[model samples]
Target: MTDKNIIWHKVLDDKKELPEGRVKTVTAAHKGICLTHYKGKFSALDNRCPHQGGPLGEGSIENGLLRCPWHGWDFDPCTGHPPGGYDDGIDTFPIKEENDAIFVGLEPEKPHETTVSDIMVETMINWDVTKVFGMVGHSNLGFADAMRRQEEKGNLNFYGIRHEGAAAFAASAYGKLTGKPAACFSIAGPGATNLYTGLWDAKVDRAPILAITGQVKTQVVGTGNFQEVDLVQGFNTVAEFNQRIQRDSRHAELMSLAIKHAILKRDVSHLTLPDEIQELKASSRAKAKTSKNRITPLTIAPPKEAVDEAVKLIKKAKRPVIIMGHGARNHKKEVVKFAERLNAAVLTTFKGKGLISDDHPLGGGVLGRSGTPIASWFMNECDLLIVFGASFSNHTGITPKKPIIQVDFDPLALSKFHQVEVAVWGEISRTLEIFQEEIKGETSAINPRNEIAARWKIWKEEKTKRLSETSDKGISSIAIFEAMNKVTPENAVMCVDVGNNAYSFGRYFEPKNQDFLMSGYLGSIGFALPAAIGAWAAVGNSRPVIAVAGDGGVCQYLAEITTLVNYNMPVKLIIINNNELGKISKEQRAGEFEVWKTALSNPNFAEFAESCGAWGKRVEHQEDLEQAMKELYDQSKPSVLEIIADVNLI
Candidate 1:
């Protein structure tokens, strides 16, 4: 073995070789590597993408490049340099084949340039203005420790939330915004349970997140000990995989699994560890490595014939509409090109807002509860509905009455109830980009600006009329969103909690780029403040992140106000003082159930923030609300702005 820190160990005897064009997982005593053999030579590197710790081993091989299973960053096996100018080296163990005996070497983690500096690098990465947000619990200690260590190492920083559920929401929103796995950490039992809402959201919404939770003490397994719960079972609520790192020998492997789950599944993963187990010292182990000898098989691209036909349908339609959802967000530029080339008006779902920038000529902003009237009418009147990269959720608040064209990576997402005219399946971004090019070649100049602006003009007229009639002088729900918008910058990021308040915030607030953050699928209310902090940390307080939270949500994680204050990150906490479960109240009124456990008394949150050494103010009137917000924003200090509103608005 060379002094470059190599270990000589036999991988296999002459009896075995990997299947042709396929990689093989070679396990050593304490580590494993995915070996790729090509032309009778082999190459290997660490198995995880340095960015989000995504699985490199499971990634496809194409033209001597190893593509990460998550985010598809391709890396050259020879030098371990990922695409997009990331030249980094992984722990490469030298392989020796002698007389049909194969051996490899492994080394300690060395300082080298990589995709991301550390987990903390997440805090610094641009989310297009979205922030890192989440709660911290005992169960998440290791994950949190890793994040904190990254921050301390000048690699990353995060906003800590009081409730684990909210943290999960923040993670979901952060992930959705950045296409990276944002994280949520909590203690075991209640902590894990609380995080389920966000986890389930991530699962359903296909938002990638890594959820970390603490487990019961290793020594007291199944003893009905305090705070002890079946984490593996509990984690089944939200995660694609519930991975328990019970032994030191399994930590690296479990981490690889976690990364694989988040990236490939495009869902949440839970990494659970017992309290003492995290502190246990283990011998140096080998990190998983990428293979050298495999190739990425090309899935036949969706026949271009079908896509060309879809384009023709768009060109002929006088009133065509494009519905952009999660799919569109993933393949933003491509979707934009397609819409523009077709001169089709675009309306995005809440989850996919800003998929096409608000500034785009064809932009209809968003379509839903808070969507402009023009957007709704566009959907209702369009003769053809072309939905790209999005699911038709009830939250969109409208169903297509016309023929629909749906394009997505998942064929199953083409319809919720409506039958699809043309269903094309492939990678959202890649396909969209391809479609755009094809459409450009087939079509001539059409004024997309005129189409979009015409719709926006009508919507703007209706919006103005509606805003004028609405009461803006009291503690109204609409007033809160409006006031916050007025005070915050155009680039402000708003991290919202789940429950009714999230609905209110998402609806009433028209956030542009860097303006809105929500766990659309997760819907965790307490996530607002923490997510704001994370966003602020990520962006270095360049813009303010306001957390619009309800009374119930605020109370669940009241302590995080102090976290904000202590960190001195530029985050504003806006508490909607609806004293009960507002969303449930609305549901009950709609004949769902009699509100029983939902009703509860609350505290003076403004004062609570003050107690935490933050500036706190309670607003009773609408006029005062805006003023107070202005004050909070001007102070640029940690503060809580409370709006005591009617209970109906929660």
Candidate 2:
């Protein structure tokens, strides 16, 4: 028998300096570990989530129970047992508090033999998943079960999104964040089809994503059972690896191949797992498939002659501009260096808004309705545009009348959806590096255009005047968002839903570092609250996450507020309390059609938020907006601030 040897683990200060009931986390043995003080006693557990190694420390805690952030796996802190039949429990260390300091005794080995659940829990303490995102559906339920099993085991974190599209978007977004391949999941049928939007977006944008989906039961294939849809057929449009797991065969090999294809192709890969097969036990010796990251291949240097040609092109041109997109986000340091070498003014699309800091000397925010005046000015004035990882779309209102030098890994993206004068096919950072070297040797200053600068100033003044006038009049959606932005922290994230709300924001709020995650391009409305939960789960309470939804959108997914309140995530939801499907209503009215069909009566949003145990407030007038915001921010809990504004504003 071994005597307990105490090893001190200092948590928060003893003076109640940190707020009571707030969970704090510490990293020990390079593992994210959670510690909390309750009822004058200290408790400690592995911070890594048991299910997928999500940061359990970041998960919400209420009473004496802790829930996993990745999934809502609830557990009692004292016993370390997850609620219900789920036999998962975390390793609890004995703790002692003495002289205002905390100490714990960690056992080198468990008193009992390790099981599969134990492996799942322990692995999350050290291992981390590259990326995980996807929609939740029936066939994928088994995968979700696998994820839950991993969570019980505690080794990694998987982030969930609203739809298959949102999942792919999140994976691509995370890839941009980490410069590595991200993992995504989806279900069969419609779920598979919805994935194309994000997968194609990833393809055009040149992002790496690993996508998984649930297929129909092998026996049901052609028989057309419930949810039995052709996943391979649906996924053919966007996925580089569209694989349906074989029946009664080597399933692990296929999963491994799917994972490998995603990494190697630098594109989206889709793997469809049948319902029963996904639940079947894998061989005990099964190992994760591995592959070299495709971004590693930068060996194809630009020929010196090609570099010289690029330099000459730059030197001879006036009003030259560089458009940085998600590609530049991956090779941030290299892109910055390249931009510095040319002294070119930079513009980014909404998706690439923060590829460089908004405060950077050259960045012009984004280019479109939400674009700064400078970006718009340069876009019209520049005769030579150096495009990198940017797609000129209707969203940007971009039309190429001048010579545009396109640089991208996706050959198809070289065009303005089929309009390009000069195309250079290669990796963005590598190509930019070659162009940068050439620019250094060239003599001309690539002089800034005075006309462009003058035009930008005038546009800025006009925009300022318009904003001021708009703010003073009947409450507009823009005014509401601007006010919200002013009160929230600089890093506060805002997740918006599709419909009139998304376009309203896209045309209104200025871009910030806080990611604007949405299901807009697909026009999915019941996405706001859940996606916000996922985003908060990803970033934690280090900052606030706000979900802006319309009355219709909120009504569709209001049940998720229970999840938010229960999780104790400090999220502030703002409902544009216009009691109608504003966009469709307006469209119908414009087309001289009946409006009642598009109109809807909604429940009291403030009451709904309160019902779920969160601070809820209603604001009818502009005068009450700031006060309502202040109250929500000060409450230090998940809350809903419903702002009743004119329906026409949307």
Candidate 3:
């Protein structure tokens, strides 16, 4: 072939790398070529076997004929012919050997054409979806390539994680923090299925997320094709918007609706891209859709009657407590203001731990099972309950017997589990604005700051006494978190796992404007590390990102530490090592059953983190905690601080 418009790429540096009678695969200008050394000469032939698209380079040379590995088809060792009787033959490429090096020449790569993936990705980016976390595989190459182009243009970023489950969790955390949809990409079958837990977490938490999965060729979809699964049907339960992209589908509109559903509905949206259809050329008339004029502001106000009822209740409430849930994350400032104006004690659900700063006079610590005495005392004594954006999950234990006024943007979320005295359907901040205006500074509520302070002092005394509790197994959980609470950045974003560690953190680690993310409704383990990755992606290096996990939960996504290292994300990971599924063991004991199969064998996680090119430290004694934590936190890279703690002490 003529050399015009050709690019020559080095295939081998030494001819001895491939011994005689050996065939190896190499890529020259993005085309796979099987380089063969037979009879003291070199030849380059197409790597595919043509019949089954098997890699001919993996085949063996027997009887001087290179045999296809899959179906045992034979081909000429030097020529591109299959055999004497065969009509199908592969193409040959120009290969030259000079100075003990082999080179293959091919025509320069052509400019990429706009494909369905390009259109969809453009639409996704136009809607301000700036981050995607996942692995790139053969089936999702087209979509990954489109994302690569966007990355080059500085439009978005793609983080290749160790597992698809981590990708989903990371995306979910990003959405939860920013209220914008971040996507998670995966290939067909197992990769797509691995995203289940994280997607369910986002769905139950009302976080906006988008999931993209590849499928086998559309023509072979139902024929039991390799790596094929009915992704649309599989994602139906987790996603509010699930669709399969087809060649005739309106590509931009599909992406628009996917993000729209995720944002407006505050849930997961899923899209399945078939392998073959991903590369189909887009029509010239098709243009990517943007968010301009696409979405409406959701600042609706509550009905006048509902506002009047809320006002009347607040006027007569002598002792009122305002409870904030994760749903009130965005409107916490307004909620805090409302609490101050009404002189009501402010309590937060476990998920809403940091909504009101613990230092605030009226702020009471988290309520329910993972709560402090201050919160529980307020709940028992308060005559009026004003719930802002809380779902009243049993975990929060908002009393059903008390007269309650619940406000939420989503009408369905108000009084979701039981009946309340008043359900005000409106945006949280907007509703608070109306309530403040209608109340007109007329109220019987007394300031509970002194009582809240007294409760905190009592709780602190109790916690201090518990910190002295010792076990031969390890240090106390209180000690570990106490060190963290002293040194950790006040504005840090904390991602927590589901276990005794999380409960201890909720109980001991007082919040001071720090935000917390967890798998609230799903209560999935191993959420901390991946969620920390997502939080890092959202905030970059501007804020600290901390992940807290128990021994059992950290094992689920341990390899993700390498992902953090690869991305240079300086996330601080704290693992409470009790060497068992401590929570499950406690549950078993509570049910009067023997603790069986809950114990775990663990490696030295601090050493493992060091091996992964990150900083690490192990804290075994309470006296060593603050120093070790300081060392771990001082590292300007990804790090792990493993603390040996007593499970029972929690």
Candidate 4:
């Protein structure tokens, strides 16, 4: 079995298992071997048919000849020779029987040569982009195998997902948290097309991500082959850099450039690999490229004049509020420091829910539609708006009429919606540093902490009143969030789906040091579970990952719960089963249309999770919510806690 050239493989099918005149396909050292038994003797032949790639083992032996399942080509069963000794024939391997056990002899597999896929994958690894979520298929087998080798070498982590869409969402979430690129892989046609929604999410949210797709063979260009689509053109609208990997392409440099674009631009970069080009041998002297000096530090400070004007405007205002967005995720310390020094109230956009702790004195919750009254009151009362890294999306409702100072790293994002008093173009952390240095003395701003506390008290009283309300239809969202507030770890990372549940969470769930991720601009449903998978990859168990979704949202990627179980990722998921698309229904009524086709017929998700080897529980009432959530988190595995709530309550 350990010989150098003729390595023996144990077929595991003993002599009794093979009847006379029968054949069965078995794998030997990763090669398929068709074992045939005829005339009280056994012989091993190659499993594949030479003509149409059919499984010869699945064919039957009739009239002393084996026939191919596809085209019925006949060959001598004993020697694997075609009728009349044709040049085309199947190869035969030596077989032996010892003590009624079967074994086949085959030459050891040839060492893999350096191919284009191998070089590209290695370059991606060298750039420290390790996480890949995707589905592997026929067109992408070469690239998948390359990744497999890299994974075996401990250089990459590839998660094979049930759906390409989930892979994209997971990669997007990883980029949002780490400010780096994670890859989503797919095959040609439908597989590649499925990634569009999640890729758009990354693009609009300014999260860096890489999308790798497979294309038809280059020889079939514009010939309309099966499952073929122009992936480069398809991906152009969603990707910052989109290209097709062709033969003789600059392999390693291409990968480096893709990674560079994703990270530096904070956008989606895509690459399409043709079927045949993926396996082409690379040049002998080719080497993987790295990100050693390609990226420079993003510490650009705003112009001195812009900073002076911003500080001057701050000094003249009585009440100044700081609005932070997802872009300021990493510079939390400096943003909070500047707010405290100026004695200004701080508000966060919905996507920036946890940028600052809600427990902080000056912290006003989320702004705009999915926001608290506390934030709305502060924004309305503030005379000056000092915005940092926020996009001023209509969802956030940052008033352009007010005197504003918007600081962003992207010059294009400055004054994107309307002109502000000062539009500072600089990196968030460095610009906040300059702001703190300039405003060393006390300003005309009032002690807003007392006012913030007063607003929070008023909101909490209303929330308490909502929480105690009972209904026969189902439990209120306030009560569900109240239970979540009790059990959720302060340091947990939450991935929220778009729905009324999101609105309720923003209004009721007080975020404290927890980082939040969502489909901020695209507002896609079904983002929660897959994004949690991504979050788990980023922070692992160091910070618990929680996904929040409504019934409609969870159903989109309901199968992904098994992905958590497969990877042993302990992601706690909360499903608010309201029995309908509550948000859409609300919108329909608001538009003065008859509500139709929004209701959902749901399953017992708790039992479904148990079937998938995960801990699960469903709570139908407020009294059982706390116990169910506690039990869900107690287990050291992926778990689901489904809460049945009233649709109208949210």
Candidate 5:
């Protein structure tokens, strides 16, 4: 019988231990089966209920009949028959007891069939979205299985995170770094809503990301079912393209469109998958979509008149300055060439830090609130401002009074706050290339390289003076950053959270060849650790990834340290523990308001890191900071260095 048709698989060790007149759920040949022991005999039946698809094993043996817990549906436990003579009944598998074990007989397994999740995942892969950061739950089991199949086939990589928020932030950072869409997955209700903050970060920063959230079964959607929420309405504002997956909807096409909108609009796109719809059988003729002629080139040149006017302004100005922002990240080479041709100083906004090396002769460092004195001096002295891809936020403080020539791919960003001399709507690289060509013979612009060097010298002297003003109570922010600047690798990827630590980093840490990521517009705390995880995923272990956060920021996602330990990620986390919300206190003082509710009671974070299975160290004095940093960076595993910092020294 085993060779001809029936395949007998051992399911339970012994039928005698199952007790009399009881039902238990077991798996045999990857199928859920309900094994019942009634009247001193063993029987097997499908575990799923006919109504509402509840588990029959969870039901009790009432009046010698199996009862489903969902709606109290009753059926005969031994013969798989209903008690009310209803037409609906479950199929039964042949069972036998021998050799102290129970074996269930089943037909030979058939070849796998494609599911709706398979089609959607295939479409996502076709669009080059292969990184998924999320959690698996009861509602999304089928989708998770589809993802598992793809991961087994080497088609994608899935990371199960500790929290849904971390998943969204990881996907956000991945999108920001690669300029491609990474997916975040979650269940319905709370799991879906937990993704809002990170999705808002992606939306505001113009990074592309895809959010896949699971929903309850379609039948119970409007009946206030468990774990059900109106996801489509919840994500309406944050997502540029939002849709729900339905049994009759085009599954592959919906996924393709989501990816398209994410990439083309550079914004969040969300999809809701009903629990039952995810497991629906796919059509044999369905095919995944690709990027074959579906996307257009984004390299647009500036208008001829605008370019001519910009050239005229460039020729007339004696002192010119170039301001770059996050949007100009990919076009740094062209921007540098333009700056070199004009012999002008190059300043970056806080979000645009590390675009131009601070060591460059023309580099004036970051501008605005968390900026250096060198950048502000150059901006104040310049006669004409040439801005590229900058939003002109108040934090950036780009002077509107200066004669400006602004260029951006989005027309709405040009002169967004106020009017400028020239508003050139074009792609950043193409516009810079045009400027380089148009200013070939114009050598009248002053060379500010010498002045830039002098200004940097003055700022360094001031920083040195501040670093010496240390307190016996705790380490100063300047001292911590000074040690970091000396020990941090040149090629490291740095993620900074929002706080006084971030401010000090922007002011003191001179980036060589590093890439800096931050919350930028959102200014959300607790962003560093999760962003560091995403950065490590993007670059792997080839380069070091560091996260800089204040004590208040690190405490928000403290459990994620265990996640790093679980993956053995080589991330060096530097926490400036001031035991207070230092940035808020400074802001309160600046606004003439009493600093209240800003102080925090904290724990020994280094000890916590060690408890989480990562290398941990604490630094109290300025003299020990460098050595602690060295020890932490030398480790081949995840590590943390917590410095007791002075709250008043920032």
Candidate 6:
């Protein structure tokens, strides 16, 4: 009698398709079996070669024996034994032919065992990493299976993107919006390299993100295997913590440390998973780590002496200003209270455009190159400057000549490039709270809110003047942004790409109680659409998600528009079709060089959007801009509004 556990599965309908004296691979009971037909007899053996784990079934039969294609190793086709009595033989499965069909018998499989990937994924979930954006490939199948199990349990959500760059950008934006680490995954070599740009975006902007890369097997890591690269060396500079996952390593502990470094440092953490190690059986006693006592509170108060020095500076100045950067995003309420208590005008950097509502009494618009003149006017006349979590990038001309009090949680960021009157190293919100409490009886400082209002009035008039300066070349950027301001929801989250579109948005679009996300320090193009996808994933359909990009920027990741359609993300993409790299043209003319290679031939973006199953409209005239924008925003699905803007007017 045969073993009762053996089950027969029919794999081939007709033996004629395989031909005589040939070998082919078939799947039976989820296992690969090599079926060989030799001398009018059929035999089934394990498809995997004993050496290098190559697929033996794909090999050809030569000289009355089966030969592996990978290394030309020969084995007896009928018996499961290698040539020359090497003592290594492949396992054989019973085979039978019934009604011109081939069937192979396989024993019942053992219970599924937990793998290293399963252990690490559980650890990631323990740390509350709920979302992952990535591509699944041959090298990452085992790890992907682990993630699939987590998805089945409702512990994680995975989004498959068109490119690895989009995955990285999506993860970066998710981190920025939620202040939690979302992961980006890719295969080794080119797939991993594609993540560099967006990872740098997250790194420099201080967003927490985890990067998981699939590497070649550990045995072939240094052998120059196909699709293999030294991922640890490649990601060294961009990642705060980079490590390789090994069979002997404590897998769950490694994942725990990676997430902790990402969240605590607000930086990118990376892990390289080799092909074989990903599927290794884990220790039965292994457990996932958590954040029960590992995380510390972030609210450190400023030193008494630094706080006193700041108070003296604020009390002495007649005109004072408060400038916040993206770092102050999470503590805007405390910052507003501090500014209100001192009667100081609040201004923001281009990256921090929406930290304080433009409708606020003390709110002065962005303060530098992409900013309104009103912010520069206030900064020019102010006698004292109180900086909060701002990097004095040249793009944001926070004047170095003024008496400045800089407050930050990171000590290295204090006076990074130049000196200041006082450097208060502490959590930004806590420092602001101390300022609000310590400066109760100050009376010498001039209140700049009235001046702010007056300057805004003048700037609005100038904007109105620019709006009418349109030509037949195309619609003006001023008109486009003015219409956007009229139609965009107050609570929307805006993701702006790098280019003239970003500058124009900063100059014209007035944000009201909105959240702004951008590739701040890295200043990468093609960031908006992918980041908008990430923002939508973070907040769902609760608040509107908007993407602002130029024609050149949109072209970089145009395929992501389809991703938005598939997910029904409800993202409103506004493309300024200027037919040129407008910012580069401005730079060329500014440097006394003629514009070159800046011209672009663009397609009908609205039609392209419609083809991707989304609502799309092209606005060619100023009169139609507002209505088209309104219709796009009112829809519950993804949409695109392409505005033909004059490149020269931008």
- Highest lDDT: give the candidate number: 3
lDDT of 6 at 267: 98
Model 2 compared with the native: what TM-score? 0.69
Q: For model 5, give the 10-residue run with minimal summed lDDT.
A: 1-10
Between 1 and 5, whose lDDT is larger? 5
Colliding residue pairs in candidate 4: none
True-structure lDDT of candidate 2 = 0.65
- Candidate 3 segments exceeding 4 Å error: none
Q: Please, what is the whole-model Cα lDDT of each candidate in the order they appear? A: 0.66, 0.65, 0.92, 0.91, 0.90, 0.91
What residue runs in model 2 are displaced by over 4 Å at the alpha carbon? 1-145, 158-217, 247-249, 263-267, 279-285, 291-306, 332-337, 356-359, 369-373, 441-460, 467-474, 518-530, 552-556, 583-597, 630-636, 648-650
Residue-level lDDT for 62 in candidate 1: 79
lDDT tens per residue, model 5, 48-116? 998777888888898888889889988889998997788899889999888889999989898879999
Q: How would the candidate models be sorted by lDDT, starting from the highest?
A: 3, 4, 6, 5, 1, 2
As a whole number from 0 to 100, the lDDT of residue 368 in candidate 4 is 93
Collision pairs in model 5: none
- Candidate with more favorable, higher lDDT: 4 or 6: 4
TM-score of each: 0.69, 0.69, 0.98, 0.97, 0.94, 0.91
> 1-650 in candidate 3: lDDT tens per residue?
57886678899999999899999999887789999999998999999988999899999889999999999989997887977878888888887888999998887788888999999999999999989999999889889989999999999999999999999999999988999989999999999999999999999999999999988889898998888889999998999999999989999999999999999999999999999888999899989999999999999999999999989999999999999999999999999988999999999999899999888999999999988889999989999999987888888888898999999889888777888999999999888888988889999998899999999899999988998888778888888888888998898999999999999989899888788999998899999999999999999999999999999999999999999999999999999999999999999999999999999999999999999999988988888889898887788999999999887889
> What digit string (tens of lDDT, one per residue) describes model 4 on residues 1-650?
44667988889557888899998899998899888999998999999988978999899899999998889999888789999969889999988888889999998889889999999999999998999999999899999999999999998999888899999999999999999899999999999999999999999999999999988899886899989998888888899999999898898999999999999899999999999999999899888898899889889989999999988998878999999999889888889988888889999999999898889998999999999999998888889998988999999999987889999999999999888999999998898778778977748988898888898999889888877788888889999988888888888999999999999988788899889999999999999999999999988889889999998999999999899999999999999998999999999999999999999999998889999998889899788988888887787999999899999887
- Model 6 pairs whose backbones collide: none
lDDT-wise, the better of 1 and 6 is: 6
| C-alpha-based local distance difference test score of model 1 | 0.66
Clashing pairs in 3: none
lDDT of 2 by residue, 1-650 (tens): 23544445555446264344545676544345677655555677777667766777777677567777788777776556787768668877666666766555554433433232223222222223434666668777867666655655554456554456556655654443444555677777777776666676555545566677777778888898777778788778778887776545555445555545555565677777777666565556544433334125653454565456566778777567778765556665576566666666778776566565554666556777546667877878777777777767676655578677777766666674766667777776677767765666564446453544665567557655654543332466766766765676667666777667766676456555566655422445655665566566567787778888888887765766765676587888888877778888877888998887766788888998898899899887776777788888777888999888776654
